[model samples]
Each structure stands twice: as structure tokens, then as C-alpha cells.
Target: MIRRPDSLKTFLQAGALAGLCALALLQAPKQAIAGPSGVAGTALFQQFPLLYQGVLVEGMGGAFTAVADDSNAPFYNPAGLDNIQSSSFQILNISADISYPSLYPTLYNGVSGAGNNNQNYINAFSSVAGQSLYARVGDYSNYTTHDFAIGLLSNNQMLGVANASPTTTNLGSLAALSDSGVVISGAYGFFNHHLQVGGTLMGLYQMFENIPSLSKTQASALSSTLSDNLSYGFGLVGNLGAIYHFDLPLNPTLGASILNVGTANFGNAGSLPQLINAGVGIDPDIGFGRLLADIDYVDVTNYLYYTGDSLWLHTRFGVQYQFPEILTVSAGLYEGYPTFGVGIDLWAVEVNASYYTEEASPVPGLNPDHIVSLQVAFGWM
Candidate 1:
């Protein structure tokens, strides 16, 4: 049964989440490392850090800049907060992602004695080199009403890549990163709701550790703990966004945003580069269900660097269909890789799953890493 709660209860729920976020940001454990975090492993890819990437948004090929209408609005494009019709609060949201297609088989073979049985060792090592393997876990919660939103988000990931050069004595490189933060956002509508402009401010606590080069002998003799090499930092970031709705067929909406304006600097560690993204979303009034389609050009500034010689890696396209209050399905292309996702909602509980591939090497189609993600959430609307 659905029983509407009083405003006081809603406010209390929001406050609890707020307190938790504040505590997380202020009470991070201190680390006493001398080297800067991510100094080694991150040399492979020059991409920026995304403090919060909602599962639903990523499931849709990360094309939510123009279609950010849900709890993810505050992180994607705060201007979409104006689309909320009523108050909503999320009590719990957790998600995890891991590389798929079973890298385990080959990894196990290499670890066991079977890999060295013949020239198979060379083949296996060659295949694994330069390939990125990763796992991630995250939790998020938020409260939103009308044109205002606030949320807490945390994400942790471990990424590794094997060394391919013949001159290097290192076995591989590994990096662990964590980000926890609070985000507050606000927006205002103009021209009778035809346009919306918004801004977001985020306070973050981050920690990172990287092992640039390590040999098997050194690994066997290692004595350092996960915290021994860890480095910590803090940052304040901002985002600005605007959306314009056209009064034509399909109800087209054009959106643009600048994330981490002027870059998000974390002292002693590193910084997340600024990105400008633009996209368009359309909602067609069809019978029996809701349909949304989006096309986006993300990180426009890096187009020349990422796609000048290789395949275009900045385009995203997605489409989703929702069946009333029960199920939702989505599909799209993320940087030329296919992605699919599904969601089921029951009462106040929701479950979502997605499958996609990420290009780890400089060029697309060279080194693809298959990944799967799952999420569970509890909320009140």
C-alpha cells in the first residue's frame, strides 16, 4: 500500500542524508604519503574524473546531459531540476560494476602453471598487456523538490593495466581511487518554463593510490598496506547548465553544460579537467508509454585529442521506453560501443542492470573492456 507521508517526515529524511554526507566529507582519514596520487597509473589515459555517474545515466550511453529528469539531474545538468513536479527522497542507492567476458579465465591461466607450459605464456602476456581491467562500487542518495536538489555520492574503483614494453621490468600498474562528496543545486525557469538555467556546487573528499611499476619479485616481497601509498585531497567544483524547450513536435529540448568549470583541483594529488557538453533530447507523445531519445557531444574540447587520428570517441546516442510504473528499457551507442540496460520498479524499490563495453586504449576498437553494472535503490516519491 502507498501512504503519503507528511512534509515533516520528508524533511527529516532529507536531513539525515545531509548529515551523513557532511560527515563523510569532513571525517576522511588522513594519509601521510610523499608522492602525488595517480602520478603513475593515470599516465595511460588523460581522462578526467567523474565524481558521480548515475547507473541509469551510464546505462543510456552516458547521454543524460539533455535528458536529466530524475535524481541524476543534479549531477548531469542541474537545470533539469525544474522538471520535477513534487518532492522526492532517496533513502538508499547502491551500485557495482566489474569487467565482464570473464577476464578470469586468462588471468587464472597466467597465474597458474598452465600459462608457462609452452609459448602460451608469451601469447597470454601479449594479449593482457595494455588492456585495462577494473571494478567499481558506489552509493548515492538525494532529495529533490521543484527547482532545488541536494545529494550525497560516493564511488570507489580499482583499475589495472599490464606493461607491454620490452625494456620495462615492471609487471603491471594499478590505481585505486575514491571520491565522496555533497552536491547542492538550484535552477529557475524563464519564459513561462520555456527555458531553465541552473548551477551546482560540490564539496569533495578524494583519495588515490597508484603503483606505476611492480615486478613479480617485488610484489612477493611487498610490505606496504593499502593506506601506506595512499594520498588524500579536497576540492570544490562547480557546474553551469541551461536548457531550452521548443514548442514543436516531439517537444525537443536543447541542453548545454560546463562541468568542473576551470577544472577541479585537488591539492597534492591532481585535477579533473573541465569539459563542455551539449546535447538534444526529444519526447514524443505516443500512446501507452513514455519515449525519450537523446544525442550528445560530450567533452567537446577533447575531440581533437581523442578523435583527430582515431575514431570519434565523443558521440553518444540513446533511447529509452518506460511502461508506466513497472519497467523501463534502454539502448544506445557509447563511443561506438553498444550498450543495453533494463530497470524494474516495485513499490518503492527499484532494480537496474546494464551491459556495455569501454575502450581503454587510445584508439577505439583496439582494446575493448566489457563491463556490467547493477544497481538497487529505495526511495519515496
Candidate 2:
């Protein structure tokens, strides 16, 4: 927890001044450009990018490509679906996260005392503080030989500044973005079940709304009409994956996948980038539990197509221990940040929880964001 100083009001004054300067820059005119210079680059991709899915994978720090065997295989390495023996179904899966609001003391702490003059600017700064919510519901079941699954996923992000004045209900400025989609996935095994291949198709819808910094004159009327400014669109994308299991000790597995293969677009809004990912996993059975370790290399093409920045490497490593069928514990480094999670099985239901950190920017120097997620899943073999 951050300690609050008695001079927090003074800090708010300084922050308000900074906000004014930033607003000035945002209002400046732009030049017409083309090619790479015109591209929005990382900022565009950072908005609502497809995140690593599933509480188990997140707890393992997103190193599940070769270890995928459960319903989430569709998002990780669909080929692993062939490993399933029973026709399992995930009745409902929902997950949500929020950055620790405690870090932004200016917005929540000592804010009620901010002077009327600094309140608007404080709100503006709070609007872009990186807050988001996500939820998904899906089901996966195996057939006689081939395995298949379908799911619906949605995400929403909001940033805004709200007035601290007791008499006002107006938000100073706001931006909200959302994405919703359906995924269809299938997998097949060959070569005596040594090699498996899988694919996923997605249909997506996206929406975004931004309410510009409010002027005193427009605040009253604009506050009431903000919903009218929303814009939305739809598009499609696909993923292909394969995994190979070795006949050697520990049943080590190697996996590879191409995600967002065709650079799916959301009409004129934007496009999700194509990513190439590969991973390896080793699971050795111990007397009382199973020890699992996995490592992954992601966004392979980003190094060649874009600049050779280290962030493009996007490496992840994780280790997990499963105590029979009662509980599982995991810890990992996700793109260099620490993550921890656990799963508990009770009868026919499983509950999972994880804490993960994400860098606001791959370029460094930005503060990290923390999220805690809890998921409940019910299924029967």
C-alpha cells in the first residue's frame, strides 16, 4: 500500500497542471502521413488485444501451448484436445480483472478535498488509467475420434474522469471500448496419436466511444448525449496449431501455433496482429504429485516484420504441481513478470484464482498493472 502524505492536495494541483499540458498536446493538429510512419503501431495492438485465456494457463504464466489438454486448448494449442478421453463439457466459465486501484491515489485517495479548479483535470487523467473487464462462456466436448468446441467471449475497457464536486454528476471525459466474439475449434490426431493438429475460426464484433475533454459550455448537454457517439464493426480471424508428443521419458511435448493468421479486422476500427507461437512442456509423475514445466516463445514474426525489439520475443515460463485430483498450484514468469495461481477441485466443480501483472508498455519505464481473477468451472467426465 502507498502511504499518503498530508500534502496530497498539493500533489493534485501539480497533477492538474500536467493534465492541462497533455490536453493541449492532444488538441494539436496532425500531419497527413503514409506507410509505416502512418501506422499506429504498438498503441493500436495494445487496445483490447486477445489475451492469454483460462485461469489455469494464466496461473501458469501463459506457458500452456504444449501443456494444453483441457477446454482452453482451443485458445492455446487446440491439438491437445485429442488427448481428452471423456466427453467433457464446460458448463460456464467467467473471468474478470481490474488493476489495483490503490496505486492511483490521486483518483481515489484524498480526492474529495481537491479544489474545484483541479478536479476536472484530475478526472481527465483518471480516464486513461488502464481499467478493463472480460468475461467468456464456452463448452468443449470430445467425439469418437475428433474433438471440437465452441465459445463466446467478450471484453470491455473504460477510462474516464469523474467530477469530485458533491453537486455534479458529470464525468469530465470518457472512453469505452469493447469486443465480443464467437470461436469454433476442432482437433484431430494422427500417427498413432503422436501428432495432433487443430484449428479455430472466430467471428468478432468491436465497439469504441470517446468523449472529448469537456468544455464548461458543453459539459451539461454533452454529458447527457454521450451514448450517441459509439461506433462499432465486425470481422473474422483464424488460428492453426499442432502438437507432437515424444515417446521418451516424462512424455515431453512440443507445440506450435499461428494465431490471427489473416490479420482479422473490425471494419475501420483496427486489426489484430498475426502471431506465431511455439512451446515445450515436460510433465513427470512424482510419488504424491505431478510436476509440470513449460516454456513458450511468442510473436515470432514480430522480430522480422517489425523492429528487432526484445518485447517481440515475449517469452513465458511456468511450473505447476498437481496433488492427485484435489488441488493444483502454479507459478510463472509471464513475459518477465511474476504470476501465481491455484486450483481446487470439489466434487464436480473446480475453482481457480490467479494474480498476474502486465506491463502497460513493452517499451519500459511505465508502471505495471496488476489483476486478480477468479473462475468457477463445472463439468463431468
Top candidate on TM-score is 1
Please give the distance, in angstroms, between residue 237's alpha carbon in candidate 2 and its true position after superposition: 2.2
Clashing pairs for predicted structure model 1, backbone only = none
Overlapping backbone residue pairs in candidate 1 total 0
Error of 1 at 18 (Å): 34
How would you encode candidate 1's per-residue C-alpha lDDT over 1-381 as one tens digit per residue?
A: 113335565455445334433432332221112222343227323332456666767778878777777777877788889877787777888998888865656755674553223343444545576666778898888888999988887988877776674112465667777888998999887656666777899998978776777555444344563456678899998887777666668888787777776667777656665556778999778888999889888765542244434434777888898898779999988878988999988858889898877777668887778889999989974
Task: Note the clash tally of each candidate.
Answer: 0, 2
lDDT of candidate 1?
A: 0.70
How far out, in Å, is residue 362 in model 2? 2.3
By summed lDDT, the worst window of 10 consecutive residues in model 1 runs over 27-36
> Global lDDT of each model?
0.70, 0.60
Q: Give me the displacement of residue 20 in model 1, in angstroms.
A: 33
Error of 2 at 277 (Å): 1.1
Scored against the true structure, residue 162 in model 2 reaches a CA lDDT of 41
